[model samples]
Target chain A: MYRMASIIKTESLVKDFDGLRAVDNLNLEVEERTIFGFLGPNGAGKTTTINILCTLLRPTSGRAFINGYDCVKDAHRVRSSIGIVFQDTTLDKDLTAYENLLFHAYLYGLKREESKKRIEELLQFMDLYDRKDEPVKRFSGGMKRRLEVARGLMHYPKVLFLDEPTLGLDPQSRAGLWEHIVRLPESHNVTVFMTTHYMDEAEVCNRMAIIDHGRIIAEGTPEELKRMVGGDVVYLRAKDNKMAKEILKERIIADIEERNGEIFVHGVKGDVCIPEIIRILGEQVLSVRLQRPTLNDVFLKLTGRQIREGSPEDEFKESIRSYRRRFDRT
Target chain B: MIELKVVYVIVMRELIKFFREKSKLVSTMARPLIWLFFVGMGMSRLVPQDITGTDYMRFLFPGIIGMTILFSAIFSSISIIWDKEFGFLKEILVAPVSRFSIVLGKALSGTLLSSLQAMLIMIVSPLIGIYPEMGQIAGSVLVIIVLSFCISALGIIIASFYESLESFSMIMNFIVMPMFFLSGAMYPLKKLPLVLKYAATLNPLTYGIDGLRHILIPHGMLDFPFYLDIFVLLSTSAVFLFLSTYVFERGK
Candidate 1:
């Protein structure tokens, strides 16, 4: 978040893939030199919104501009001003990592000398210089992702679009990638527009928009979004939740969600209310817990459902991913 | 409106990939060679000599070249499917290059690649007691280039709708085999029944094979003039180039 003006702006953007409205009338503004995150679950129109901004897909109606160029009418100029790392692996598996960057550079018409210089710098920046000449098929998932990010920056575009860059990465790989991604604003001085289903990934962004069913449900800095949930989450198992929830609502003065004989209270300052809740419920409470608001909780509060299928279910996908990895390797 | 530099970049990228798959180059020629040597020798003894005014292998050489280019064009178009599945097509769409530039670049590269394979098959011409004049070889290459351009565009346009290699090849087999067979690659169109002759004439490949016959045969074996081959192949290529570009620009 530098003191730069908006580089990406959309007004009433809509996209209908056949009869399905993948993107509703979306309005968004992203400043230059900042990492903006589109946070959502699967099929939440994150990729659709990115496609519109990148000028890869024409919107059914409305308008989008990147770096002052209209996405539709100024498609060529808009493309010149932005680079993208597709969610799917787009590199030539048969070609070396260096060759992939080479083709990308030439496609943008970078001068030979300048292309060489930039490719080296980016490969080194991504810590992939040693493996530059090796075919991408042999690279690990993390290395391939790093190469994709580097490819997206070859043109030195004003904005870089990454659609789920770290989707199936291991935790360590994800952290390693974010170190490079989170540094782009300061190092490359480029605006980054990215989409992700991972909560912690969204928390790394300077600003975020939570989209669901082709519409933005919430948008702000991470802290602001968490604050929108109104306060801390306090859940308690009581000997009598029916009695305790009613009593806590009268005494504690906070919003309470009663589910399956458990009392989950919202908007209460945990330290202040925990003591009061303990004293009031005294012997009737089976267990009490106070936790800070997480982005998952924020989504849960807004949509009344988890942002993803929860971390455990994601771990299942993660296992299936390793199976895919083995299959791809063989 | 097309940027030549972008076109060159795409063609260079495709060629580099083309060269890496040593197996692909070998295999493209192998199928046609098997037909030229084994099937042609076997069929030459059975078919009457006066019917062709030369051996069946000599008459079949040009048709084999046509088949080689046709099959090679279809195989070359498989790269487009990989381009889609691997998401390279998305990368190009998001780049500064024009869609028509991409379409022309791919079509031209495919033409060159298939022509190169067709040229390798040309090396075996003397085995059939036919010595190709340099002029004849150059003329045949030109015809192959245009036919490759025409067929590649058709394959690319068909491949555009398919995301998977299996489905694309499956659909291609159903279409490509009929296009080859109906082109009279294995028989003389002049001897076919009236309905079959009409169907053969409808195939753009019929003119290309006819062109190869005119160029490669010493005795005049052409049913149509040499220029008509160039005219039909070139015009068909122009039309497909336009259609494929339009379909690609629609961005699926």
Candidate 2:
């Protein structure tokens, strides 16, 4: 059983805008100093949850706490504890990178000398020391993202919330940011709570919650989630191998899926299931291969749908439904 | 201490952006100067002296200063929507600072920019025939800064609920222009209709204009009390500051 050692916690938290609930009765426990990734399709209430925790958006009902401070009643304390990087790049285009950092430091109440030292150190860390005096409008997408991260860290917050931090960056920039994210926890002991749609980004999280329709369907380490789909995944290809999946499901309790003329089976002991699967298919088995289970599989098992095809309205409806479920459960 | 820092950061950002757009400042000042040169002189002859206790060019000075502050504050705040479009609001909101600080910072920056524009217009006002003594000039400048702060607060409140720059600009046109006309900027409040007179009483700019008039020509023929005018202006600014801060703290 997972212990409830949460730096931030929500219980039946709901956010209603007019009649619609953007975030339905959300109950989340983010552990301290962990790289907790929030995986959700767009409009799945990931941003809303972060807003509530950051004390930006007030919850319609229920309670949320950041480091044990109520999001509403103790909003000031909550804000002091958490730093957030929004989905859209927020650097002032007209200001130099150094100026932007200085401004943010001031907003966070850092003194001049300390802020200057931190800005210098952060610029060096981000490899942006030479570009510090350049206006952010002239910066590349990756450079802007790096400055934003450094700015967020200037306050030395207890928790950092990143909303789709690398959404529009290039592949190399995305990978580079991942490297920084990997070291964030170890360097600062600051809890990292982030949301991203990128599959590769989700894989590196210390723990992640796969959210769909405003509800957390699965929560675990990347390996643990993949294992939820079963330990090893086998891809069986045949000209007419329809019986392969049925045989495998009967022989071993495992998940079976088909895509592009291939049958995918997930099982705890894959090698043992393969022979039985082969025997059942007989001469029909053209080829068989084994590989790892992915977060995509976990998404598929929980939602009965792919994350990409999900519409905003569907997410809104799911959010409302989850709110009702939470209401009833409570 | 935190609020002051936030305000300073906001003001610095606003100033940097304003200075970067040299074209905007040039065009904005050019439009007012054209009016000061052409229409102000023509209107000075057409309009009577009883309306403002001086020539129309002199009357135009205070109105132009107030108008500059009004337009600057309103136009600059439309960037709140731009901030939303650019996603900067998220970064600011997520910072470990109070929302009041965010509102204060934005308002102070916009107000300071508008007040600076007003100051430039004041320097030019004398060339157009409205002269103030050095002592009066400082007090009038102080009043203009306060007026800008109050107007900027109104802008912040407007930006809080509106989502798009187009919509905000449209609303500003509808509200700001009418408020300018309805106030005694162009004519004395007493010369207008009773309905307008009462309405003008509510316009913070009315008191601002009155206060400027009092400070500029302290021994003038105006019947309105300077203390009352200053008090009303201060109170209106307080109301706006309080409301803007409240709406801002809510974070939309």
Candidate 3:
């Protein structure tokens, strides 16, 4: 296999806010023409990392580069080679969809005729050409998201950065947006570096990094990351759970844990073990389930916590984190 | 050259938004006229003519032009607050264009809109029986442009510190009011208290209105030399523009 050069690289990037470290000595590399997902929970420094890469925020120490241009020193060149769809709606609500894209074209120094052609092509591609002349305020959340994605491609950038592209979108819209995003590398010949917390969304990436507390805990393809969970999970509910555990323990050498009345058997071939376990423990088996490891399970195995279950304490921490960011900026 | 184009597009977006909002256009145009007729007529009756050296309405005419530019120019930066609130500012900020271009583009648009309002007020000068000569009108245009740019830059400087429209309204009540009242737009600086006269001298609009008086009301009592007015307005606008650009770039 031919190796591809990194289009995005960061060398021990560190960003501190008033003595609180947001990103701590992070190193990341994303190859050209690949969809690289940065996966993390809220307050994981995802936005800060993307901001640094897009030249919106300067790193406190170390360096980052996009398309070979230093994010800090050669910010202008880096900006020119990249496009960004921020987590929020960055479109001018008062302007028409066409006008918004045109403004971007002019900012990027596209010629008048070329910009018009590109805007039309992008509007059509995003399925927004029919409503191109309408003000963006009239657009649905899904439509606005699509227009934003279209706007990000207006300059034919070498790399596109999406910070939570499907955040706050309905499941249908999320799927719809992903369809468009998945086709981007082939159609636009651009690398994608996106930050998403959704496990399902991260699965779509060609490669991904799972970050926590500003550090990447794991980085690999979806299959590789899942394989780290050891093996398929088998959940067995028997009439006598203690006897079942004893019997299963004698036959199979694997980690067995009980949670909420179900015996979870880990690191086993589910198909091979389920039949024997059922046959041996015949009438004692009440219910049995075989499951493959998902990205969520992998996160749970690595971090000992579910990714999506944000307790009240986590919400409080997130709010305080955001307040600190705002205070620091001011 | 690309930076210039970046500036141009930013200005264009503002102009397009300004023209689209008909109510805003009508209200901005109407505000000066209301003060010109209602407040000018009411105050003319209370003040004696010898103090102003002309009919009080004629004296208020130049002041009204100052008022128009002051309000229009400062409030134009509300577009910045609007952009911030709606997240559109991130689009411009993330672009490859220089921050100076962004500040210049905003200031130029504010200058254009405020100057347009100032000219519209000048057209209504006939209603007050004061017709500025063609030369006077031409000179006032230069003063108006300079003053508008100065005040708009001031607004952008304030805007850089804020992110919400509610904070902007607080600014309107605090900063905008004080600047307008002290600008000598409604009264002669010579007649003001000693401390206020000093405060008025520090105001760019005072120099601006004074410059307009030199051209629009040649016989009207002038506090400072016309050259000083021009000098102060030019230097202050340059300072304001630089400061605003600095504040924007420092955020990174």
Clashing pairs in 3: none
Task: Give the C-alpha miss distance for residue B39 in model 3, angstroms.
Answer: 1.0
Q: Which tens-of-lDDT digit does each residue in B76-177 have in candidate 3?
A: 966788887788988988888888999999999999999999998899888888887889899999999999999999889988888777897789788888
What is the TM-score of candidate 3? 0.90
lDDT of 2 by residue, B1-252 (tens): 247878787778888889989999997777667776687788877887753367767766676778788888877776787787666766677666766777778878888889888888888765866677888888988898889888888888888777655686577678888888876777778778899898988888888888887887554435369888778777888898889878776554
lDDT of 2 by residue, A190-223 (tens): 9999998877788988999987656777888998
Quantify how close model 3 is to the true structure by its C-alpha RMSD in Å: 3.9
A-chain TM-score, model 3 = 0.83
Model 2: residue B102 alpha-carbon error in angstroms: 3.5
A120-228, model 1: which lDDT tens digit per residue? Answer: 9999999999999999999999999999999999998999999899988898988899999999989998999999988888988999999976889999998889888
**How much lDDT does candidate 2 score?**
0.79
lDDT digits (tens) for residues A69-111 of candidate 3: 8998888898899999988899999999999999999999999
Candidate numbers sorted by TM-score from highest down: 3, 1, 2
